[model samples]
Target: MVDKGGSDTVFRTEERFRQALPDPASMAGWTPRSANAEIEEAPEPAANCGPDADWYCARIARGEANFEAVGEEAQFDLTAFADRSAAQDACRKEKTWSAKYTEAQVPPVPGVDSHAYYRNAGGLDGLNLFMCTGTVVAQVLLEGEGSSLDPATAHSLAQLFASRIHKAAAAQ
Candidate 1:
């Protein structure tokens, strides 16, 4: 979009993804971070698109959740894919570790196909999570003064998001 003189500021949020996105009400303390959910569609003639080219994105979504409380601040992201394989591919490509965090492998929640967690490498007080479900990719991040987001909690939250995705797909 930059090439076209457009920017993220100009991209309209699409409702097509709302059905499968994680609901803020599903978690306690944490509330909606963004005013509304945003759509993340794949570009036409997408680069490296899998068997299903009319894709939603590069990453998949997962189900698992965190109810025990992550911290004073938090956010969630959900990306949809055309098929499970495309989502799986995105999940597998997740970085082993990011510059600011150390990673840990976690088992996939109930219906999730894969999962990963990363804690602030500096012991600062934050955690980031990623997971993959049949046709969606979801992420959760909790941050606060001395806040902690355990894998089990993240898994629980992920499961909720994943179920929504499954339900939406079934409806279609």
Candidate 2:
């Protein structure tokens, strides 16, 4: 889950180990009677996911233990983007690109109407996605030490961060 407070934020998840399941299609002498015969059912939620449990407990109960949150607040300087030219210059210096949007983007946040995306042009490492809601500009940074994440993963991380920021802003 994503957690943002002050200038510190993190998207993280606990590690989990699961046994590999046998592939249904590879099972010997097994065949479906009809294409519609096999109906997939949603897994049941864990017992501790009720309202009485803590947020972590709920997440764990929902089988989201393996999920990882992939952004941090302090990694991106939102104020840097106040001046578009300067931001672009910084991006250039860092071998990155700034993607500004005149229209709304996907992975929508509740309070954000528009946002900017920044990432390494070579797709190595480092990424920032920020949104302005009222006077608050929420920014999320994705830069893992010695690890490079794909654009889709970075966007997902930004979405998670933005959602948290929007929720907190709405509460205030």
Candidate 3:
């Protein structure tokens, strides 16, 4: 009887399942030092902004340096794509299909739900990533046919796309 947000609960559970994850304070392999009882330190001074300065940013900015500043070459610009229209047209073309298969068609394998599945496939690079939502389990399957993409590559690509989707969905 889980609600609409149950996927988040399941995701959180999976994160917690990561073996031997460290505590927040002792994150990864770093152990932060305890706070001292000495007198409070003064706040750091701000940096200068000049007319000659090309760009200014912060990492945790202090003094004359901006830690988070990106160099000119490192700056991101979407103008790299000369044929934006063609790229957009290609992306807009989504290849999708669905089928209702008989129960006998499904293998009697463990860990795979055979109750029902409505699959949808579409992605860039002709990547065969399927979203299968069934009565028992909701699964994402990435398969590749022919010499285009191997199973391992397809699986990795699927994981990358899945991660992007998960991130976008979380933001909503």
Candidate 4:
């Protein structure tokens, strides 16, 4: 998880995070699976996370423990969570990139705390990136027909998204 190290400047609204979303147009031919980019909520804490987690993800992130963990293997810890935060924490660990993907060279993204790149580890088909800037963590996955997204493309996309996050962060 790419969380802010000691900063509290979390992107709590989609509008704020929207400024940091990568423009899909930057990738040639490949189109977004959804018309809009999505936001991921922070790791759920048993105690309310200061101000109720990132509002951007709060609205869209499903609030139930019944959600399935999408990956090569089924997740055992998904069910029976006490609340949304517990479920989200468990779910994040079982996610495809976390559970079934292998690490590759992370692209050089400027002005960010840290970042990582991942590719399908087994039967999966996608390239994933998890990055942090300030108090926000962005999880990016690019998948398409036939073969998974190429490294060159993933690198370019990572840079694109990072630049957006960097720009918005600078303005703040």
Candidate with best TM-score: 1
The lDDT per prediction is 0.50, 0.32, 0.22, 0.43
TM-score of 2: 0.33
lDDT of 4 by residue, 1-172 (tens): 4333323344444554555554344444443333333344453443553333433222222111011112211100001223334434433443433544466566645554443445544555656655444444445555433544556655665566667655654556
**Cα lDDT tens digits for candidate 3, 1-172:** 1111112212122222121111233232323222111111332111332223222110111111001111100000010011222222212221111234211122222222112222334432222333211111122222222223334433433343234323422443
**Best of the two (1, 2) by lDDT:** 1
- Residues 90-152 of candidate 1: C-alpha lDDT, one tens digit per residue: 555553324345654445656555446566545556566665555455676665666655666
**Per-prediction tally of clashes:** 20, 1, 1, 1
Model 2 misplacement above 4 A: 1-111, 114-124
TM-score of 3: 0.23
RMSD (CA, angstroms), candidate 2: 18.3
Reference-based lDDT, residue 125, model 4: 64
Supply the TM-score for candidate 4. 0.52
Give the range where candidate 1 is weakest over 10 consecutive residues by summed lDDT: 1-10
lDDT score of model 2? 0.32
